[model samples]
Structures are given as structure tokens and as C-alpha cells.
Target: MSKLPGNAGVTVLGDKSVEFYRDPVSFYGQRMDRHRGRVFLSRILNRPTVFVCSVRGARELLCEKSNIFQKDPTDLMTNMYGDTIVTTNGEEASLLRLSFSSLFTGNSLESTKGYVTRICEQHLKDLSSRGQCSYSVYKSLGTQLVLGLFLNVNPDEQPELYQEISCLCTQHWHGLISAPVNVKVPMWSSGFSTALEAREKLMAIIKDKLQNDKHGLVGTLGSLPLPDSSSASQHLLLFISALIPKALASLLTSFTLALSGNQQVETRRKAQTDADYLGFVLLEVQRLWPPFIGGRRIASQDCTIAGFHVPKDYGAVYISHAVHRDPEVFEDPDSFRPERWGERNAGQQHLLCSFGNGPRSCIGVKLTDAFLKEACMYLLQHYDWCVDPSTQALQYKWLPVSRPANSPTISFSRLDENPPGHSGS
Candidate 1:
């Protein structure tokens, strides 16, 4: 611990255990300045950890795919999603990604088009009915779309399934982020117990679906020729976490923010069907608001990152907030400009680490890309968006993933009604 680059004994933000609990990005951003943008040390919930901000350093730590940087037991992915692709290392993670590879074929995606279209229409219709949308609406849309796409639930059962999912996601978040420090002492927590109960209930639904030969990711998992028997366990881990919820939040936030300003998207309002433009907008949103901010890796043995020694078993944090805002890579590091992502900036697109990058990039990247593109096309071809300036621009709440801190008031009216302030494609 003493060998790390910054002053080992000092606390950042001038507090013994500085409170960045609600705002880790700011904490790391300040530390990045203090350490000259490479690396620094801080304690998350009072646990000693290393914070690495440089793009090259993050890439080295995340992309290496070696035993030297492994998943720590404390990582939320490992804690909440044991041994899944996000939480595993090297060959095992590689193989898990490979097994899911078949799920992304052109033919497979094409088959999903009609369903995706229907889900989007229904979700949009719901938004229109509500007149204004916020975090709950977005989350509900994601959960509904997920259940609608993944399962063949009867119309009567859809509400119940959504309720179950909501409970599970709520409890999962509670367990993942808000439990007590001494809660490891067993008697200190009922939250963990509640989360476990919710998990059992959710898993029961999954097991029942599997027994009845259901569809979507559950069926895809076993049929994909996974490399190990633990594939069931790994698949179970990944599904229990809210993949759709995070993506849903990202999609809504990005699209609304894109429409609220950005002349590039305005040009495409109705005249252009350039697939490239839609992709670029989504990419820009993610670059600004990555679904998950950076990630955690544990050193398996002694290893050096950008000349600083990372000792064995030490936890390393890679902050996306810092990496995404690199001035060298992005022109006006903090502005919301989608035009900056067009053809002229193609060379740096690879630098966008929204869904992560390199060998073990997000397992859901292809599925998510297909989903986002389809959603973007639906929005561009359908309704225009308007932000309620009475409401603020997107502010964040950093959980295991980033989500809107509050339900900002945003209107998504239909093309026909065309409210004066609203703009449509």
C-alpha cells in the first residue's frame, strides 16, 4: 500500500474518510488533479482502494485479460453477480463471451426486429399517455420491454412478472449499495436477507420458465454451447441483475438530451434516415453518461500500471468519468455535442468506453446495440422530444450503474399533436 504513487498515509478531500459516498466521480476527479491525472489512492466506504484515471492505464488494467488483474470479492459484480462475464477473468470470461456470441448473429437480430418494434411502440404509447416521463416511467418501460421480449407471458401475467422484477431490482440495489458497514456481522442486516429472499423468488420464476421451456436469454444460455457447467450459474448471475433497467435509463437520458439540443439530430428530424447519425447520437450519449462508470479489478500478483506498482490482492478502480472526459481524446471534454462524434471523429470512436472495451467488452454489447439502434430509429421516425427546462438537465445517482438522481420532467408527445415547443422527426 505504501508503494502506490500518491501520499499513502493521507486522505483525499482533506478528510480521514472523505465522503464521496454520493459522488465518487468528483472525489476521483479531484484526486486525478492532485495526482496529475494518472493514479491516486482513496477509500470507498472506508476501504482502501487505488483510483486510476488515465485512459491508457485503464485500458492496460482492463484490456490485459491476464491473471494479474482479477475480480475482487468486494466488487459489486462479484458480490452481486458471481463469476459472470463481468466478474470473471481471462479464458473463462472469454469463453462466456464466446458462448453468447451466437445470440448476436444478423439473422438472430433480424428475427427480433418486429418484437423490438412492438415493444418500443407500446412503451412510447405509455409515455404519450402519461404526458411526462421520469425515472420510474423509464424503469417501468425497460422492465416491461424486457419481460415482453424475453418471455411469452400471458397478458394476464405480465403485470405480476413486472412486479416481481421490480421487487427484485429494488432489493438488489439495496443490498448492493446501502447496507451497513458492520453488516458483515450478520445481525446488522435485514437488507441482505431481504435481497436473498427476492433473489429466491426471482430465481423460482426463472426455474419455472426453464422447466416449461421458455425463451429469451434463459433459453439462449444453455443452448449456446457454453464452456462450463457453471454456465447456468453464470447466466443466473447476469440475469438477476437489471441489464434492461440500466440500458433503458441510458437510452432515455441520451435520446432526450440529444433532442433537447444538438443540431445534428435536428437535421435528421425528418429528412434523413442515415443509420450512422442514429448510431452516432447514441454513442455520444453513452460517452457522456456511460451506463456503468469504470470497473474494479484486483491484482492477482504484483503488477505495475503505468510504472506504479499494484501489489497483490489490492483493489484497483478505473473511473470512466475521467477517461471519457480526457481533453486529448475529446475536444470540449464536458460539453453535450453529438456532432463531435460524426465521421470526422471516427478515429477516436474506439476510445469511447461506454460499454467497456477490449477482449471482455460488455457481453450485452451486440444485443444492446441492436436494441438501441432500433429504439433510436423508432424515435426519429415517430415523435419529437422536448425537455421541461423547468426541470434541470440530467443529474446522476451512481449506483452499481449511473441512473437519473431524480425523475426530471420531460415530455414525449406524438407527431400529430405536435405541441408548439416539441420537435419531431
Candidate 2:
């Protein structure tokens, strides 16, 4: 195999973690230009890492040779989520997946649709009246959905408890992104430390739910054949995390922005009426604006990805943004054209890594799809929206969760008052 294009650089001072995290798109874009290839070497978290930015490379790493590139044991996800499936590997991981996936598929999943619709209607019904909405507004709706679905913590029934858990989840999430240092001094503590404390409180709440409330996901998870006693609680914590809500909100926000304005009037009308067209619209939204940047793995043994050599123990990261835009796979990769899904990219959704690919793809993807469709359709049927001020910046930040940097305010108009016209007809 050909050697990786760029140098991994020296350890420590040569590490590019900060730069990569700050703006991974620019980092990979500049390097992809310099090295003239999608696969390259860099030092991330002070380890020699292979950055995969092409569709072929990502598929090879995540699908064809998935076993050879396992999840990192020391991933920050493990630190925050404990020994949940997000960090586990091998047969243990498989077992965890089989056990937990039951909660997200088939009957269990079918049961969530009604709740999803209710929550979407509950929080979204007032958007047109408010006249404006922001990322946080959608995010709150998402938060209520996951918290209620996963832990049975209804915001309306127990508002104070719901608020407390939400705040704690936010703290715990901050820890996942913060420096791992556990320093504490004189009424102050590191974000990671604060996150751990928040985790403990959240765990207590999760445990109580699992015990007293023998219903919903918490109840079902408690009854699963998990590895150990703490398994259910740990996984519950992962499920009820702020991460899910943020991701949900990210996709919803992107969908709103992408189909906004009079220009997309015909598109929105079609999507509202045609299920396949709406699916295409959602697919396009995910393609252009995936919630997470990408996922990381560790090379098990020496391997070749996209024809480039990757040494054992080396970190491997796939940039979903770049992979989805690989011109080799997507024609006019950067444009917002949902019809491309119907034409060129038809039946090729597997190529997209928005929720990842292969055996290790997200277990919660189906549930997420159900919720997103419910929320998006709700918005489509009830209201039409556009950026509140036409001149507002719509630039996006990819980290933590992808959304407009300024949290662009959107003006929503009830469709009943002002129906969308069929521009083409």
C-alpha cells in the first residue's frame, strides 16, 4: 500500500488536536489540498493518527475492514459514559448492542412514535405565535423528547426535576469536551471534575427511575440481560445525555434553514405532501449538515485504508463532512439539492456516514429518524419559516453540535394563514 500522504509529525508539541478541533473542515481541507489526497497523517491527542476524508476511505475503514479498526478504549466517551457500548469492543460490545438495540427497534421503537409526535406538537405548536425561534428553542424540545422517552422524565409532570436533570446533563456534556484534568481548588473545579459530579447526580436519578419506574426504556433496559448490575444505569445515562438532544436539534435546525424562504416554497410543499420527497429532503439535510463531525477508531493491526498504510494503534478519524462531499461520489457536492438523492445518490445512503456505517453504526438511528421525521413534518404542516432578518449570517460551527454560529433567529408563519404556492405549477 502507498504510504500515508502527510507526516504524523513529532509527539507533544507537534500535536494538532487544538487546530483540528477548532476547525476540522479547514484543517482537513488545507491538508487535503497540500497532500493532494484524502487520507493523511497527523498527531491528534498526541498520537499518530490517520485522517480519512474520502467516501472510499471511510467505507473501507468503517465497513470492509471494521474489525481491524476498533473503537478506541480510551475514548472520552468511555470516561463520561462509563463502559457503555460507545466505548466497548469485541464480543462484549456485540452483546451490549444486541441487548440495548432491542429498546430502539421493532415494538419498542414503534411505541415511541406517538410520544415523539406529541412532544414535537407540544413544543412546536407555539413557534408561529412566538414569531421567532432559535437553536436553543428546538434543542429544548429535543431535550424533552429524549429525557421523556429514555428516562420517563416528563418536563410537564415534573418540571423542577426535569430542569435539574437537564442542567446536570449539560454539565456532564461539558466534561466530555473539556480538558480531562481533575483539578479542584477553593470553590472552583475543572469542567471535567464538575462533569463527574454531575454524572453522579444523574446516575442517582437514573437508578431511581430504573428501580421505581418499571416502564419505558428504563424499565426495559433494567430487564435486559446486561453484563452486570451497573450496565443498565450506565447505558441509561448515555441514552438520556444532552448529546442526543443536541444532535436531534442540530438536524432539525439544519432542515429548517435549508428549506427556508420563498425560494424553497415549492420544495417545502412537495415535501409536506410526498413522503419520498420529504425523505429526500431529510437525507439531503443530513448529507450537508451531519450532527457530529465524525467518529474515531484505533487501528487494531497494521492496515490499509483507501490504499494508504495505517499502522497499529494509530488513531483513525473519518470526517463525515468531507466524506459526504467527495466529488467522486457526489456531483456538485456542496449544493443543497434534495433531488440529487432521487437521481445520482439513489439507494446509496449507505455511503453517508452521518450516523456512521457498518456493524458499529448507531443503534439509536431508527428512533432518531422517527423523531426527526415527526418534528420536521410537524413544522412543515403547521408553519413556514425563514431567517428572521434576511441579512443574518448563517455560518455554521461543527463542534459540540452543528448549528449556525449566531443561533440565527427564524420567523415562523402558520401555514393556515399563508399557504405556500406551487412555484413550478
Q: Which one wins on lDDT? A: 2
The lDDT of model 1 is 0.65
Best by TM-score: 2
lDDT of 2 by residue, 318-387 (tens): 9999999999999999999999988989999999999889989989999898888888899889887888
Q: Which residue pairs in candidate 1 collide?
A: 269-425, 384-424
How good is model 2 by TM-score?
A: 0.98
lDDT of 1 at 64: 63
Every model's TM-score: 0.85, 0.98
Clashes of each: 2, 0
